[model samples]
Target: MFITLATLTDVPELTALINASYRGESSKKGWTTEAHLIDGQRIDNEGLAEQMEDPNAVILKSMDDAGKITGCVYLQMRGDKLYLGMLTVSPLLQANGLGRLLLQAAEDYARSIDYHTITMTVISTRTELLSWYERRGYQKTGDVIPLIITEKFGILKQPVEMFRLEKTV
Candidate 1:
């Protein structure tokens, strides 16, 4: 397996992979599924394209031996810190360490760019996931943000809040 920068051609597959890993019935196979909390596509091609257009952002893809994208993470330079988001792994492949590897890749990228910290947000109710990040050294910054309800972000089954987490890399 290897990691590399994602290009425009990766949007379709990446979008499907992300959606499947986070929502719908397909996501039920993994522990990361947010299907119960939201009921629409997690991300679309256009959204991915828009994020890719940002000069300060990059999406890293993890490819298997056969060259299939098995995992991915979106990282962006935000002021003096690197913002990490959309970290994903194939549902069937979760817990096999791919997520951890992708996170490490994000941290490595941050350091390479001379950034001293990495930040991300997590759904406040996702206790397990929040604990995972906390175990990895991320701390709650006590900044709670309301979930943005929109066609692009999907309809929330219930009101949800997100909190910022940061770590000094």
Candidate 2:
């Protein structure tokens, strides 16, 4: 597998992959689906393009031998820390350690860029997901915030909350 920075040309595939892995029936194939609580696309092309254009942001893509994007993660430098988001792996490809590989790569990338900390927010109800991150050495910062709900991603069926998690890289 190979990891590379995503370009604007990747928006379509990236957008589709994200929605497939996080919402709708396709997302149910994996443990990461938010379909039970939200409905709609996880992200749009315009939003993804904007993320790619940010000088402090990067979307790392994991490609297979045949050049298919199997997984990806979004990272942005926020002050001294790297804020990670939008981690997605093909729903059918989850639980195969690809997510872990991508996560390690994110940490390595952050260190190479001189960042000492990595932080991210996980939905408060996503206990399984939070456990996964905790096992990887991330800890809750006790900072809770409203989960961002927007048409740019999807519509929430219920109130949502998030907890910030951090790890010193």
Candidate 3:
């Protein structure tokens, strides 16, 4: 496995992998699916390109033996903290340690940049995912933020709140 910064040329595949890992029928193969909570494309090429262009942000991708991206996480610098989000592992590869490896890479990136904290927001309804993070040393900050809804973000069938989690690096 190899982990590297995602380039613009990888956006389309990254977008599809993200959607399949988080929402849609393909996501159902993994325990991380949000298909029951929202319905729509997880991200579009335009949005992904914007993220790739953000100077303070980066998307780290994990490649398989065949050189195919199989897992990834989005990281952004937020002052002293690195905001981690959109962590995706191919449904077929979930629970096989790739997620943890990506997370370790994220922490390494944080330390390299001198950031002392890492923060991420999880959907309140995703208890299992939150638990997994807790096991990894993240603690809930008890800060609930209203979900941000945009045209491409997907439809919220019910009100969704984001629970903030933080870890001091």
- Give the distance in Å from residue 75's predicted Cα in candidate 3 to where it truly belongs: 0.5
lDDT of 3 by residue, 123-152 (tens): 998999999999999999989998877858
Ranking by lDDT: 1, 2, 3
Which digits, one per residue and each the tens of the lDDT, describe model 1 over residues 32-139? 989999999999999998999899999999999998999999999989989999999999999999999999989988889899899899999999999999999999
Candidate 1 colliding pairs: none
Worst 10 residues of 1 by lDDT: 146-155
The residue-by-residue lDDT of candidate 2 on 1-169, one tens digit each, is 9899888988999998998999999999999899998999888898889889999999999999998899999999999899999889999999999999999999999999999899999999999999999999999999999877777688989989999999999
Looking at model 3, residue 19 earns an lDDT score of 92
| Model 3 weakest 10-residue run by lDDT | 148-157
Kindly indicate the candidate among 2 and 3 with the higher lDDT.
2
RMSD of 1: 0.8
TM-score of each: 0.98, 0.98, 0.98
Each candidate structure's count of clashing pairs: 0, 0, 0
| Candidates' C-alpha lDDT | 0.94, 0.93, 0.92
